[model samples]
Structure formats: C-alpha cells, structure tokens
Target chain A: MHTLALIFPYAVAFTVPLLAASLGGLFSERSGVVNIGLEGLMVSGSFTCAVVASRMETVLGPGNPGALWMGLGAAVVVGALFSLLHAFASISLKANQVISGTAINMIAGSLTVFLARTMTGSGNVRIVLGFIPSDIPVLSGIPILGPLFFTKTYATTWLMAAVLAVAWFVIYKTPFGLRLRACGEHPQTADAAGINVYRMRYIAVVLSGALAGLAGGIILVTYSGEFNGNVAGLGFLALAALIFGQWKPLGILGATAFFGFAATIANVSQVIPQFSRIPGLLLKAFPYVVTLIALVLFSKSSQAPRASGEPFDQGKR
Target chain B: MSRFKNLFTALAAVVLGLLAGAVFMALSGSNPLAGFYYLFRGGLMNMERIGNTLASATTLVFTGLAVAFSFKTGLFNIGASGQMLMGGLTATAIGLSVQMPRMILLPLIVLAAAAAGALWAAIPGFLKAKFNVHEVVATIMMNWIAYWTVYYTIPAYFKGTFLETESRRIPALASFRVEWLTNIFRGSYINMGVFLALTAVIVIAIILEKTTLGFELKAVGFNRYAAEYAGIHVPKNIVLSMSISGILAGLAGATYYLGYAVNMQIGVVPSAGIDGIAVALLGANSPWGVLASSLFFGILHSGKGFMNAMTKVPPEIGDTIIAIIIYFAATGVLFTRLWERITRKWNKEA
Candidate 1:
C-alpha cells in the first residue's frame, strides 16, 4: 500500500469527528449563540454512546453493528438534552455566553466521570465492538480510489459524508438557513422582518448539539477504541476549525480536513521516517502549531456574524 | 443598592453552590451536614491542615487574579494553563541549570517564568488586537502548543530518574520551601509562595483601582469602539492586559511546580486555570474578591480527599459536587436576574 493510503484511513477518522462537531458549532454560531461547550457535549455524547454500545454488545452478542447505530442515536438525544442548559442560560437567562458554555463543560465532564464510576465500578468504560472494514461492492473496484477510500472503511465515515452534504444544503440553500444567518447577523432586523429570532436560535442551537453528539459517537466507535470520558480538546479544536472555516459548512469541511490531516501526521510519525526524526511531542503539538499559525495568518476581520456573542433583546433596540 | 449587586449576587451564588453540593451529598447517601463538616474540618483541623489549604490556594490566587484581570480588559485568557505551564517549565529549567545564591537565583527564576508566560499570552493578545482573531479559540490552540512544549522540554532536558512523565526534582536551594516556614506550619508544604501571592494581590489591587493604565484597560473592555474613540490605545492595552494576566499565572506556576510540587508533570494543563474563571466569577472580578474565593476553592479542593475517605462517596462524586458549585457560580448572571425579580416583588408587596 502507498504511504498516503496508510495515512488516509486515520486522517478520515480524525476528520469525521472534527468536521461533524464544527458543523454543529456552525449551526449554533450562525444563529448567534456561541457554543463553546461543544467539548462538553462531545464528551457526554462519547460516554453515553460507549456505555450504551457496550451494554448492548453484551446483550446482543459481540460485533453486532446495530448496537453501534443504536448507541449513536442515543448519543444524539443525550447531547441535545444536555445542551438545553446552555441554550436556556445564554438565551432566556441572558447569561454570559462564555460562562454558560464553560459551566456546561464542567458539569458534563464531571457528571459523566461520576456516573461512569458508579455504573462501571472500575471508574472507566470501554467497548469491544471495533471498527473493522469491509469493501464497498462496486466502489471498491475503482483504480486508485478503491483501496484508499472504499476498503476497510467504517460505516460512520459514509454517514459523516452524507451529513456534510445535508448540512451544506440545509445551511446554504434552505429558507431556514437564511433566517438563521439573519438572526446571527442582525437579530433586531431579523425580528423586524417577521422572523422569530429566538425560535430560530433555539432550533439552531439544538441542531448543533445533535450534530456534535454524532461527532462524539463517531469518535468512540471509530477513532478511539474506547471512551475515556474525554474528547481531549477536540471540541475546542472543532471551534478553531469553525472559526477557520469562516462559519460556512463547505469551509468547515475544508478546515476540519486540514486539522484532521495534521493530527493524522502527528500520530503516524513513528511509522514515517521523514517525520520520525522530529520529537514525538512536537509532532503531537503540530496540529496546535498549525492552528495558531493559521489563526495568526487569517485572523483578519474574522467574518463572524456581527451580533455573534451578544444576547438578543427586542426591547433594547 | 445596585452598586452592591455584584457582591450580593456572588454571595448568593456561593451559598447556592454549596446547597447544590449538599443536595448531591444527600443523594449519594451521605449526610449533607457531615459532608460539609468534613469538608471544612479537613481544611481547618490543625495548623498543618490550615497551612496545606493555604498552600494549595496559593496557585488559585494567582490564576484567579490572572483570569479576573483579563476579564477586566474584555479578553478571556483561556490559555492561563498554557501560561502556567510555560512559567513552570521556565522556572524548572532555571532551577535545574543554575548554580547561584538563593537570593539572586530565586528572583531571577521567578522573573524568567513571568517573562515566558507573558510572551506566551501576548501572542493571542496581539492577534486579537491586530487581526481580529477570537481570543477564546486562539488561546485554546495556544494551550495545546504549551502542553506539547512542556511535553517535549521536560524529557529532553530534565527527565527524572524513574518517571518519564515528570521532570527531575529541584534542589532545595531552588525549591519554594523554606525550612523555617515548614517547621512553623508543622511540616506542611506551606512556603513563601503565599506571601508572593499576597504581594501580587496588593499590587494588582492598586493597579486596577488607582492607575490610568487600569482605567484604560477597563474602558477598552467595556466597549472597544468607545475606548478607541477616547484615544485610549486599545490595542496596546489589550497586549499589556494579557501580558499582566500571563505574568500573574506564571507566578502561580512558580508557586505550583517549584513551591507546591518539586517536579513538573507533562501532558496535563493545570486545572487551576479553568477553576480560576469560576473563582473570578464568584469573586466578582475584584482583586480581594478573587483572593477570598481562591481560598474558598482551595479548601474545597484540599478537603475533598478527606471527605471521600470518611464518607461512602467516591472521589469522582466529590469532584462532581465541586463542579456543581462552579457551575452555579459561573451562572451568576442568571441568579442575579432572579434576585432582582424577587426584590422587585418584595418592594411591590411592601
């Protein structure tokens, strides 16, 4: 196999979670809520998915694929429900967006660890339903793409690709997208135009949570073999990707892929002689270095929504 | 009355946070009163316990001051952990390499740590001021960069004899512990770090309350465009503000790695950095408020272990209880509004 082929699988795995989570951020930020708690949401979702899948695996016999999907579904619901706290704090209570988001992070992280300790008894949770690849029927026959794209890939990758497509359409072409963007850019004007700005924001935030939850689920069943009560700052990295992507779905895909590619190189450096000479720690830090440089280079007038972090108040304007 | 609202809200938050923890303790099948009693008693049982609690709080004081200072300037310094790491790493690097008199060497190492931390934080501050990068994302990215920097630096330079995960222990001369203070505290880890923290508190209080520079920074935080209109040099102040915040956190790192623990550990951002935000929020971002809250948090962190040992509740549950307190504390604005509504209703009835 070509070197790129070996690296492609892991890169795709890395891309899936970051891309999904950033898409979640895109939805929330586009509707004017800054969802910094994406990390917490991802963590809770990962734990929920892992625990559910593990229990189901025990009952349904090992290697049952349906159990994985069921876990993913549960994760989506849990993530959204968890995020409602953030939505309520930031919206109705008019709390500081940053504080509210971080509070959610603290609560989610500690709560999951506490529950897992009580439920699992060993203070950790792991699942044995691993991601083993099977070749797609005809797509596996394609020349260079066959081995790289279609061989031994998990079903979750295809699911993410489908999600990206739908997300792009929903956020770009749909009427709902227009209203969401309007809510973020100018909630007062959006309200004047008969858009229910608050309602739109709520929907956008909830949708973001659902997608982020899916990202967490994908990470557990694919990238990492076990859930460790951590998405390990992937949520924050996703936020970086969201900002880097300029808060557009297509741009987020590109940004997340770039980060995913950096992360893949870091983890696989021991196998590649060219990268082997560099310290392993530097390689681990490579993605962050890349992110910082990208931020510095592109930090100009971040095309963020004008009213991004402010609470919308109809009375004030 | 509204002038004292922030203080009132913070007090309410602390009380509510404790109540929430008590509720969790009750649910966990432990007596809430006993839990509270153990929690406080562990921190105040003896001179040694008091010393240890204060020693633990020493880092929180600096990190809280760092966060609160940055909050005043309208920037979120999420990279305080990274700054702390850099400070600790620099101090450790100095302690490992230098052979000099204690008086000269200590101040030199402390300055080096502060400079490194300030430089680390200035990157995000500069980016935010010059290019419009959001500090939250940029600082988080900086954190990983700092984390990896320590990960690489420690093993390459000061690897311990047994543990690959931490640096070699600092010699006694470079250590923050003084023989007299340790004896006075009955062999607790208490050191001169607490004094350093107190001095920092006073200096920061003066800076925030009595200086034009502080006023400029606060104005910029309140409204950037308006500050710009007032010719306050907003960009300069942003960088300066972050630099100051970083310096404080770096001091924390000095006390933490050099004073609290003899060796620096790899692959973990200091939890004190995030907890600092809660301390600042509960403190209402005042210098003295931050100090008070840091001490409160210190007791919770230090006493948590004993609470677990005495009660049936696990360590994770104890940590969760602390998290619940922080969550409620950070949601001060929500409670503030609630407080305001109740007050209005009371006045209407009266």
Candidate 2:
C-alpha cells in the first residue's frame, strides 16, 4: 500500500508524455498517415521546450511559473513547423512514409544536438525549474483512489487525462471524426462524398505534430527538467503503446500507464526491496518484450485503419 | 542508360544536401565556404586522416551492405545496430577469453559474431514470416532487448577494471588491427577490417548478382505473389534474406568493436546502423553503390571533428548533411521530374 502511493506519482509523471505522444500518433494513424517520425517530432519539441524555458528563465527570472507554459507553447509551434517537412515529403512528394520518418528522426536527432551545442556549449539545456506536484483540494480527501491519483499529481497529468477524454469524445461522437475516419478508411469514397481527403490528412498530421511536441514539453517541465538531444526512445515506446492500445484513446491510456509503471519500477527497483529480486536486465527489457508479444497477438485482428500507410489517391479504385 | 540516370540522381542529391547544410551553417552564423573547405581538408590533408576515413568507412560498408541486402528482398533490416551489438559482444567475449594464433582466432571471432548477429535477426525474420508482424517494429524491439542484454551482461561478466561502462580492451592477438596494417596507415586506426570489408563487398556482389538465391530474393521483392505463383517459398526466402543481411551486420560489429576500437561501450546504439540506411538509400541499394556512398560518408564523418576544431561549425553538420541527403533521396520522384524539366528546357534552347 505504501509502495503504491510512493510509485503512483512517478508512474503518472512518466505516463503523461507517453500518453500525449501516443494520442498524437492516434490522430495521424486514424487519418491515413503513418507517422513513424513521432520520435523526431518529440525530440524537436523537447529541444524547443528546453531552449524556450531556459531562455525564459533569464527574462522572467528563475522559477517563474509562467515560463514553463510558454515553453510548452513554443514546443507545439516548432513541432508543427518541423512536421511540415514530413508532411511535404509523404503527402506532396508521395515518398515512402517510413523513409521520410526515418529522415526526420535522423535530422531531429543530429540537428538539435548540433544547435544545442552551439547555444549551450554542451548539447544539453538545463532549466532552473520544473513543475511541482500538488494535491487536489477536495479530491485528496478521498480513500485509496485519492491517495493514488489526487494527493500528489502533476498539472500536466490532469491536462493529458482531460485531453484523452476530449480525444475520445471527438473521435467517436463528432462529424469531423467521422469524416476523418472515412478518409482513412476510403479516401476516394470520402472525396466522392465531397470531403477533402488531402486537407483532412494534413490537419491530422499537423495535430499529431503539435501533440507530440506537447509531449516533449511535458517531459521537460515534469521530471526531466533538462533537454538532452535524445528522449531515450519514449517516442518509440509511445508508438508501441499506440499499437498495444489498438488505436483507441482509452486503450492508449491503459497501454501508456502500463509502460509508465513498468519503466518507473525498473528505474527505482534497486532501492525497493520487492522489485530487487528480479534481474535488472529482465526489468529493463520487460516493456519491449511485452510489446513484441502484443504485436504478434494483435497482428491477425489488427485494428489499424485500412489506408493508414497508403498514400491517398483520388483516382484509385 | 538507367545506370547513368541513377548516378546523376545520386550526385544531384549530394549537391542538394550540401546546399542544405550550407543553409544551416548560414543560419548558425558560420561561413559555409570555410566550413566545406576545412571539412574536406580535414578528411584528406594527411595520410593518417585518409586512413582514418577508410577505417570509418569500414563499419558503414558492412552495415550499408546489410541494409541493401535486406532491401533487395523487400525487408527493412533496421535491426543492424542491435545485430552489431550482439556481434560485437560475442567478438569481445571471444577476444578476451580465447587463447590461440591470431589467424585462427580472428576468423573464429568473425564467425561467432556473424552467427550471433544472424541468430538475433532471425527471430524477427521468423516472427515476420510466421505471424506477419511488421519487421520495422519487431527489429526496433529487438534493438532495445539487445541493448539491455549488453548493458547487463558486460558489467556482470566482462567489466573493465576502470570503467563499468565499457568492456576491457581486446588483446592484440584477437584484434583486427595488425601491426603491419597500422604501420601502413601511418598509425591510423585502419586495420585488416578494410580488407575484410572489401572482400565481403566482392563476395556479396557475386552472391547477389550471380546466384539462384539472389534471383529468388529479388523476385520476392518485386512481387511476392508472383514469386509464390512461380513456386518460390516466400517465407523461406524472407528468412534466408534476413539471415544473410544479419551476417553482414554481424561482421560489421566485429570490425567496429574488434577493429575500429579496442573496447566495446555498453549504452550506445551505433549511429553506423542508422547511417547504413542513408548509405543504402544514396547508393540506390546496390552493393557497389553502398561502397561508394559509405566512403563519401566516411570522409564527412572523419572530417567533421577537424572541421569543428578549425572553424565554428559543429561536428553534427556531417550528420545533418547525411540526413538531408536521405530526405532528398526519399523524394527522388520529385527530383526526377525537376531534372526532366531542366533537361527539356535545355534541349529546347539548344
């Protein structure tokens, strides 16, 4: 019981970025674009967030609360802008989406480190402040659930949870969501029905970019508090969550939470008695191994949007 | 001829990549011309630097070939990095523990590395063939698994006295770095690995172009259904193609760990694995083309640090340039149209 409370906040903190990124992936894959570049987009966002937060520190003074929010906003904008390169190659040039995404990953990985080195004399930008966890006013008074969920929670955790709820509502209940699904399912049919397939896809990819960037920002402002050139494959893990969740909002929420808990436990296991019995290697490899198994299990009945990786052609049958 | 056209496209991509790199340099407030000058000179101004360029190209040559080989069978072997780690680990273990003559020991190390890499990749191949899982995701998972395995195994079994992050330096007899080869390169890190890479290139070229297996793999790549209709076993071919691809990457690991550097580091996923994708792309997935592109990339990589020291340009500019080239290569169709327009206009003017 004590361990649960102690582990809860850390797990939620880890899950937020992944949830945001997986949700971002959900949007792109739902709209017929396979966004393998989420990792790169997140890195770009993280770099932008770190730079903005660190720069804001000088102007607004250290520990100014508003700086982090501003940083998250900048990350979103930069991520959207950077994703345009992928959008152009995959959508306009009709290049292979996987190849374009790989290029994006390489570009983001190297360019951010290159620029960061130039800016900070090292390829890392450390911010003076990060989001502090706080208890919800009345919610903290609840029983077991409150202690685990509300007593020590990050603002971003609630923000992401809210985003997930909204995503579910929008995806299932809205006209826009219906059209988006139609475009992904049958872009030609959508075009025949007078829906603009290209426009819908562009919007979806860009939204994914923005959300992925926000995920990067969330990582920075939460536990990380610094921008290293790499996000240590969290974006890829989020991608795995996207697969594990079967492209559903609630499904992703569960998947990310599972991964988050696994990661958090692996990280703190040496100090904790219960987890120490497991080999460190097994703990580290657990999430990835599980994801691979999940992939195999889900391959036959894959819920992947039919046209997710296909380049939409209006003339195609 | 199509060969001429392919060469032209690759050259055009290279130019565009350099221009993009220049744009980045200008954005960062550095002189692009000075950067390029120093970069090329840094790679070629001395004998040792030239040797270093070849040494750098060695691992890339193997990895690029690995990617190219898998690509020939319509498989994306992004797991080359993981395979390299497994191979490197195996080679390192053998190098440290074995007692034998250099000639016999080196071949054994290479064979072990190759087997390890092949086994690692065969799992993904088996899964892909059996269950229809995406190789990209499967290979990625394999990469992380290999990463953790190495992370734990090295420290537990073969820790250096000084650093937990790296294995002990490989003994001279087990290394690819022959004294004669080192002296020939004027004390650069160049080794017998260069000869191995070249020999592998020739051998792979023959296997790909001359063998019945090559025909089957290419047939599957072009149209798997058609190949199956013609009595080829698609799953078996897929597995075989991936295993062969893994062999090259494993050899790359042996060269990288046992040849390029004396010791293996624990945490790093080799950038050469990713760079191999770039090499294969620019080379048009041809073995000879991979050799050419890897060499060019080697120059850029070897020159990058010197350029950084000589000018304000960061070493990452080389990687940025390679990435830009890949992006351009991915958009090859766009370039072909643009090129066609320019040529048509020139013909009209003529």
Candidate 3:
C-alpha cells in the first residue's frame, strides 16, 4: 500500500507529458497528417516555457502563480507558430511528411541551442517558477486512497486528467471528431462529402503543436525545473506510446501509464532496495527496450488512419 | 534535360537554404558574407585543412551512400547510426583484442564491421518484411538499443584512463592512418579509409548500374506488387538492400572511429547518420551525387570552427545555419512541386 502510494505520484507526473504529446499525435494522425515533429514541437515548447517563465519570474515576481500559466500560454502560441513551418512544407509545398518532420527537429534542435547560448550564455535555462504540491483537505482524510490520490499532489496532475477527459470526449463524442477521423480514413470521400480535408489537417497539426508545447511547459514546471536544448527523446517515447496505444485515447492513457511506470522505476531505482544493485544504464534503457517489445507486439493490429501520410489531392479520383 | 530536373530542384533548394541562412545571420547582427568567406577558407586554405575536410567527408560519403542505396530500394535506413555504432564497436573490439600485422588486421576489421552492421540492420529488415512493422519506428528503436549497448559495453570493457564515457585509444599499428598517407597530407589524419570509401563508391556504382540484382531491387522499389507479380522476392530484396545499406554505414563507422578519432565515445550516435538523409536527398539519390554533396557538407562542417573564430557569429549559429540548410535540402520534393506549379502557370500564361 505504501509502495503504491509512493510510486503513483511520480508515475502520474511522468505520464502527463507523454499523455499530452500522444494526444497531440492523435489529433494530427487522425486528420491525415503524420507528425513525427512532436519531439521538435516539444523542444520548441519547452524552450519557450523556460524562457518565458524565467523572464516572467524576473518581472512579475515569483510569488505570482500567473507567471507559470503565462509561460505555458506563450509556449503553446510559439509551438503553434513553429508548426506552421511544418504545415506549410508538408501540406502547401507537398514535401514528404517524414522529411518535413525531420527538418522541424533539426531546426528546433539547433535554433533552441543557438538562442539559449545567445540569451543565457549556456544551453540550459533555469526557471524560478516551480509547482508546489498541496493536499486537498477532504480527500486527504480518506484511508489508502487519500495518500494515493490527494495528499502532496501537484495541481497540474488534476489539470492533465481533466485535459485527458476533455480530449477523449472531444475525440470520441463530438461531431468534429467524426469529421477529423473521416479526413484521415478517406480524405477523397470526405472531400466529396463537403468536408475540407486540408483545413481539418491543418487544424489538427496546429492542435498537436499546441498540446505538445503545453507538455513541454508541464515537464519544465513539474519534473526538470530547467530547460535544456534537448527534451532527451521524451517526444519519441510519447510517439512509441502512441503506437502502443493503437491511436485510441483510452489506450493512450494505458500505454502512457505503462511507460511512465517503467520510467518511474528507472528514476527511483536507487531508492528501491531490490532494483538498486542493477547497473544504471540497463535501468535507463529499460523503458526503450519495453517500448520496442510493446511495439513489436501491439503494432501488428494498429489501425492507423488510412490516408495518414498522404498528401490530399482532390483531383486524384 | 528532363532527367536532370531533380538536380536543378536540389540546387534551387541549396540556394534558397543559403539565402535563408543569410537572412538569419543578418537578423542576428552578423555579416553573412564574412561568415561564409571564412567558412570556405577554413575548409580549403591549406593542405592540412584540405586533408581534414576529406577525412571528415569520408564518413559522410559512406553514410550518404548507405542512405542513397536504401532509398533506391524504397527503404528509409534511419538506423544508419546504430549500424555505424555496431560496426565501430566490432572493429574497435577486434583492434584491441587481436594482435596481427597491419595487412591482415585492417581488412579483417573492415569485414567484421560490415558483418556486424549487416546483422544489426537485418533484424529490423526481417521485422519489416515479416511483421509489416514500419521501418522508421523499428530503426529508431534499434538506434537506442545500439546507443545503450555502446554506453554499457564501452565502460565495462574498455574504459579510458580518465573518461568513463569513452573507450581506450586504439594502438597506432591498428589504425587506418598509414605513414605514407600521413606524409602526403603533411601530418593530417588523411587515412586509408578515403581509398576504401572511393573503392566502395566504384563498386556500389557497378553493382547498382550493371547488375541484375540492382535491376530487381529497382523493380521492387518502383512497386512491390508489380515486382511480386513479376516473380521477384520482395521480402528478400528488402532485407538484402537494407543489409547492403548497413554494410556501408558500418564501413563508415570503421573509418570514423578507427581512423578519424582514435577512441570510441559512448552515448552518441554519430551525427553523420542523420545527415546522410539530407545528403542522399540533395545528391538526388545517386552514388556520385552523394560523394559530391558529402564533400560540400564536409566543407561546411570543417569550415564552421574557423568561421566561428574569425566572425562574430557564434558556433551555435553556425550549427543552426547547417540545420537550416539540412531542412531545406531534405525538402527537395517541395522545390520539385514548386517548379511544377511554376511551369504549369507559365504554360497557361504563354
């Protein structure tokens, strides 16, 4: 019981970013645009959040919680703006989606490092804004569930859960969801039925960028408290989770939980007596190895949107 | 002329990429002209610089070929980094443990690297062929496996005297830098790897252009269904192409770790692996084209340090500039489409 209580918070914390990023992937892939740029988008978002939060901390005073929120907002906006480059290259110019995504990664990787060097004299941007965990009074009073759910919980955890719920509802229960999925499965048919395939794809990609950016902000405030030029392949891990999830919202939650738990185990291995003796590199490599195995097992039945990587052309019969 | 349209499109992308970098430099309060001036001069000003550029380009040439060869067979070999690592590790292990004369040892090292790389790539290839797993995901996963493998193995088996993250330096006798080549290049690290790379180029060119096997691979690339209908073994060809691609990448690893750098560094897949993608794109997926474009990229890379020292532009800025160029260069399809659109509009107007 105590072990569960100890491990749950950190797992949830790790899961949030993967959840956000995978959800972002869902939005784009379901709208017929394959977005391998999620990692780059997250980098842009993380850098933006760190830069904004750091500056905001200096000006608005660290006492204000609004500074973190503002930083998150700026990250989302910048992420969306940066994604326009990918959108334009992949959609408007009809470049290979994979190549365009790779370009975004290269640009983001170098641009952020460049900016960090110029502005901060280093590749890292440390932030003053850190989230504090608070106990919800009534929930904290419960028996086993109390500590697991309420005590010493960051507000962002609840926010992420809420966002997850909202995302699921929007994707599964809404008319827009129907149209977005239609665009992915059959863009030509959707086009004939008066759905604007290109517009839907653009919106989906932009939303992906926004959410990925927000994930970056969440990661900075919750986990690292600093922004380096790289996100340490967390974006790619989210992508692995997306594949493991089979492109479904609830499945994504399950997959991210599994990965997050694996990641948590790696992070807390030193504290756990049983896991402490293992070499750290093997532990570090544990999640990725699991991802590969999971992919090999789960990817066979993955029902990816049919037209996901294709360029929409109305004249193509 | 029509067959050369891809070349023109790639050139246009290069020019536009350079222009965009210039704009970025101006916005960053640096002289773009001065930056480029030093960049070129740095790559070519002296024999030492020229040797270094060739040494650098040798890895790119092999990696670029690896990418281009796979591209010909309609596969994206993003696992070149992993393959390179495996190859390098194989050579490094053999170089360290085995005591042999230079004649037998070096050839043995290159062959071992190729075999290791081929085996490493064949796993993903086999998976892709059998399970229909996307190569990108599989290859990326292989990269991390290779990364962690190197990370663990290097420290455990061949830890350096001071650095925990790197292997011990290779003995001079086992290295590719022959005394004659060193003399010719005036103490530059120009090595036998360059000759090996050139031989690979000619051999691959022959294999791709003059062989029935190449014909079959090309058919598979054009359309797997059509090729299957024509009695070609699609899965076998896929595995074969990827293995050959991996062989090139492995040779690159041997050259890079055994020749250019004396020791193996842990926790990094070489940048040349990913850059190979852009190289293949800009080179129009041709063998000779890869060699040429790799040399050009080598110039940019070798010149970056000098450019940083001479100009106000920071090294990070130079890196950003290269990234921008890679971005543009890799999106050659965009330029092709733009060209098509322009031509259509011109025809309509005329």
Candidate 4:
C-alpha cells in the first residue's frame, strides 16, 4: 500500500508529458513526416515556459494564472517556430529525416543551455508559478486513490487526457485525420487524390512542435518545479515511448505509464531497505534498458507508416 | 551550371546559419568579430593550444570515421556514445592491470578497447540484422544502457576513495607516450595517437575504396533486396559494418585516455562521445573531410576557455557555434537540391 501510494503520483505526472509528446508525434507521423526532434522541441518549450514564468513572478507577483498561461503560450510559439527547421530540412529540402531531427535536438539542447546561462546568470532556473492542486468537494474526499491519482493531479494531466481523446477523434473520425494518414501511408497516392502532401507534412510537423512544447511546459511547471540541463534526455525517452507504443495513441499512453512506473520505482526504492544497495543510476536507466528490449522484441513484427521517413518528391514518385 | 548553383546553395546555407548565430551573439550583447577573433587566436596563438586541439581532433577523427562507416552501410549508429564509453572503461582497466613491456602493453590495451567497443555495438547490430529492427531506435536505446552501465560500474568497481569516483592510475608500461613528438609539438598533448588516427583513416579509406567488404556494404546500402539477389548477405554486412564502426569509435576512446587523460579518471558522465556526432555530421562523413572537421571542432572546443578569459562571452558560446554548424551541415544537401531545381526551372524559362 505504501509503495503503491508513492508510485501513483509519478505515474500520473509522467502521463501528462508523455501524452503531449505522443500526440505531437501522432500528428507528424500521421501526415508522413517523422518528427525526431521531439526531444529538442520539448527542451525549448520547457526552458521558455520556466524562464517566462520566473520573470512573470518578479513583475506580477507570485499567484498569477495569467502569467502561467502566457508562459504556456510562449512555449507553444517557440516550439512551432523551431520546428520549422526540421520542416524545411526534411519536407522542403528532402534531407534525411533522422539527421535533420538530430540536428534540431542539438540546436535545442545547446541553445537552451546558452540562453539559460545568459538570462538566469546560472545554468539552472527555478520554476516560480507553482501549480497548486484544486480539490472538488466530493472527489477530494475519497480514500488513498483519490489524493494519489486525482486530488493532487495537475491541470496539465487533465488537459493532456482531454487532448488525447480529441486526438483520437481527429485521427480516426475526421476528414483531416484521414488525409493525414493517407499522406503517411502513401503520399503519392494522396497527392494523386488531390491532398497536398507537403502542406500536410508542414502542418503535422508544426503541430508536433506545439505538443512537444506543451510537454516541456508541463514538466517544468508541474513535475520538476525547475528547469535545468537534466530534462534534455527525457525527450529522447519520450521518443522511445512513441516507438514502443507502436505509433498508436492509447498504446503510447500505456508505454509512458510503464516508463513512469519504472521511474517511480527507482525513486521510491531509495526509501525501501531491500533495494537500497542498488545504485540509483542503474535504476534510473531501467526505462532505457526496457526500451531497448522492447524495440528488439517488437520491431521484428512492428510496422511503421509506409512513407514514414522518406521525403515526398512529386516528380520522382 | 547546376553544379555551380548547388555549390552556391550549400555556401549560402552555411553563411545564413553563421549569420543567424552572429545575430544571437549580438542579442546577447557580445561582439561577433571579437568572439571569432578569440576563437581563432586562442586556437592557434600558441603551440600548446594547437597541440591540445590536435590531440582532441585525433579522437574525433576515429569517432567520425565510425559514424561515417556505419552510414555507408545504411545504418545510423547512435550507440557510438555507449560503445566509446565501454571502450574507454575497458582500456582503463587493461591499462591499470597489464604489466607487460610498452610495445606489448600498448597494442594489447588498444586491442582490448576496440574489442569491447565492437562487442558493445554488436548487440544492436545483431538485433537489427536478425530481427529487421530499425538501427536508429535500437542504437539510441543501447546508448542509454551503456551510459548507465559505465556510470554504475566505474564507481562501484574502480573508485580509489569515497570522494573520487575514478579508477586507479594506469601503469606507465601500458601508456602510449611519444616523448620526441611532444617536443616537436612544443609540449602539447599531441602524441602517437595522431599517427594512429591517421592510420585508421587511411585503412578505412582503403577498405571503403578498394576492398570487397566495402563493395558488399555499399551494395547492401544501395538496395538490400538487390544485394540479396546479387548473392550478398545483407544482414552479415550490416552486422560487420556496425562492429567495425564500433571498433573505430573504441580506438578513439582508448587514444584519448592513453595520450592526454593519463592517470586521470574519466568523468562519471561522458561528453566526448556525444560531440563526435557533431564532428561526423560537419565532415559529411567523408574520411579526409572528417580530419578537417574534427580539427575545426577541436579548436573551437579547446579555445572556449580562452575565449571566456579574453571576452565576457561564456564558454557555452562554442557549443552554440558547433550546434549551428551541424544544423547547416545537416540541411546542406537539401538546400543544394532546392537550388538546383530552381536554377533548372529558371534556365528552361530563359
């Protein structure tokens, strides 16, 4: 019961960011553009949100919801703008998607560090507008699970879940979603059918940027309560979750939960006597190892979108 | 005309990236010219700095070759970081334990590091070849595992004291110090490692340009189905390419430890391996091109401290510059193709 209590909060916390990134990924991959720069986009978003929130506190005082929303908006804008680099390279210039994605990652990683060092006068920045839990009278009264899962859940978690539902509807039950999937599976066929493959890819990549940005914002505002160099690698882990989930919306949510559970175990194990001797680094690395095993086991049978990484050339195709 | 247009496009992309970087510097209230001055002067002002840059570049050359080698076989080996880490740890272990003569100890330790790197990379390679897994995903996941394993193993098994997390100092017998060349380089860190890196480049170049293995790898990359029909074992070539690439990356780690970081333990988290990707990309994954690119990155990296001292700009500016260079390099091919198309359309209209 004690372990379960400790595990639940982290699982909920992990879901917020995971769903955002996976949805962002879904948007891109569904439209025939593979967004590998999801990690970088998240980093840029997280940093921007943290810095803006911090600055806003100094100007507007501590408890400003307006400032927080503005910070979130800033993150979305920055993420989308930076994603244009990937869009230009992969969609317009027809470069290797992986290389372009990795380039974005490098740019995001370095730029954030550089900006943080300059603006904060230090390598790390603390989050200021901390999200306090709002309790509904009846829901907050429930026993252990209430506080663990719902009562303490941040606004972002609820928002992400809502977004996931909308994403599912958009992806499977809408005309836009059909066109996006058509673009991914066969851009040439989609082009012949009058869908603008390039335009769809651009929109998908930009939307991916925004969601990844929101994931970054949620991490800084809700989970870490700070921004630092540490979050750079988490984006990559999210990428792992996307692949492990086999590119499905709900599947990615489950994969993220699993990873989150692993993280919580590593964190909670510190208090338990039986697992105290295990090095924290090894435990921290558990999700990555699991991801490796999952990829090896599932990749043989897993199928990616047909035109996933390939740039669509109208003339050639 | 199209070739000329393509060249101009590539040049323009590089210029635009640098211009954007310069704007960033201006926004940060630093003089771009001053920063460039410090970058160049600090890198080449003294023999010692030059040697340091050369030494750093030597390792990057091998790692770049590693990345480029796998790329030729149509694989993206993001596991270079993990492979390099494993190699460094293995080399350090051998360097401390071996008591043989210098000639024997040097080769033995180097070989051990290479073998360890190859073994580390082989896991992803084997998985990819056997299961048809995407190398990018597998290699990246392996990188994280390698990072954790090295982080834990070093501290648990090799720490000298509670405060220090590094292993014991490596024995002098196993060290690959070239005292005479050090004098010629004006007491810089340059040593036999540079020669070894050059040799590796030459050997790789020969294999890629002149050997059957190279042809097999290229054929697999060109089209796996066709290669299979042509009697080439695509899976075997993929595995072999990654293994060889891993070995090269391992050699880089060993050389760095043996030549410059002697007696010092590597940091709990590694940086050199990650930086190699930037070098490899900037070099366009060409052997000779890698040599120049690695040296350029090395100079930029080593000169950062000097730049900070001379100018108020932080050392991280160097990283920003390298990141910009990589971004441009990654998209250079794309910009070139775009330029070619535009020019051809314009010419036809004319």
**Candidate with best TM-score:** 2
Error of 1 at A128 (Å): 2.4
For candidate 3, write residues A88-140 as lDDT tens digits: 77777667788788778878887887778667777799887578777899989
Which residue pairs collide, candidate 1?
none
| Tens digit per residue, CA lDDT, model 4, B274-350 | 66777776665667767877888788878888887887676777777777776777778756667778878998999
The DockQ of each candidate is 0.68, 0.85, 0.61, 0.60
Q: What is the lDDT for B313 in model 3?
A: 62
RMSD (Cα, Å) of model 2: 1.4
lDDT of each: 0.86, 0.91, 0.85, 0.80
Q: Classify candidate 2 by CAPRI docking class.
A: high
What lDDT is obtained when candidate 3 is compared to the true structure?
0.85
> In model 1, where do residues sit more than 4 Å from their true spots?
B341-350
lDDT of 4 by residue, A1-317 (tens): 76676568777787678778878987888787878789899999988998898888778877477777777889888999999999998998888898888888878877887778778778688866577656556776789756676666677778888899998888889999999999999999999999999999999999999999988888888878788754646677777788888888888888888888887777778787766788788787888878878887886678578889989999977
Q: Between 1 and 4, whose TM-score is larger? A: 1
Off by over 4 Å in 2: B342-350
* CAPRI accuracy category, model 1: medium
lDDT of 2 by residue, A189-232 (tens): 89999999888989888989999999999999999998889899
Lowest lDDT sum, 10 consecutive residues, model 4 chain A, at A127-136
Compared with the real two-chain complex, what DockQ does model 4 have? 0.60
Estimate the TM-score for candidate 1: 0.97
After superposition, candidate 4 runs with Cα above 4 Å error: A133-136, A230-232, A277-282, B1-14, B162-164, B263-269, B334-350
Docking class of 4: medium
**Candidate 2 structure quality by residue, lDDT tens digits, B247-344:** 99999999999999989989999999999999999999999999999999999999999999999988999999999999999888876887778778
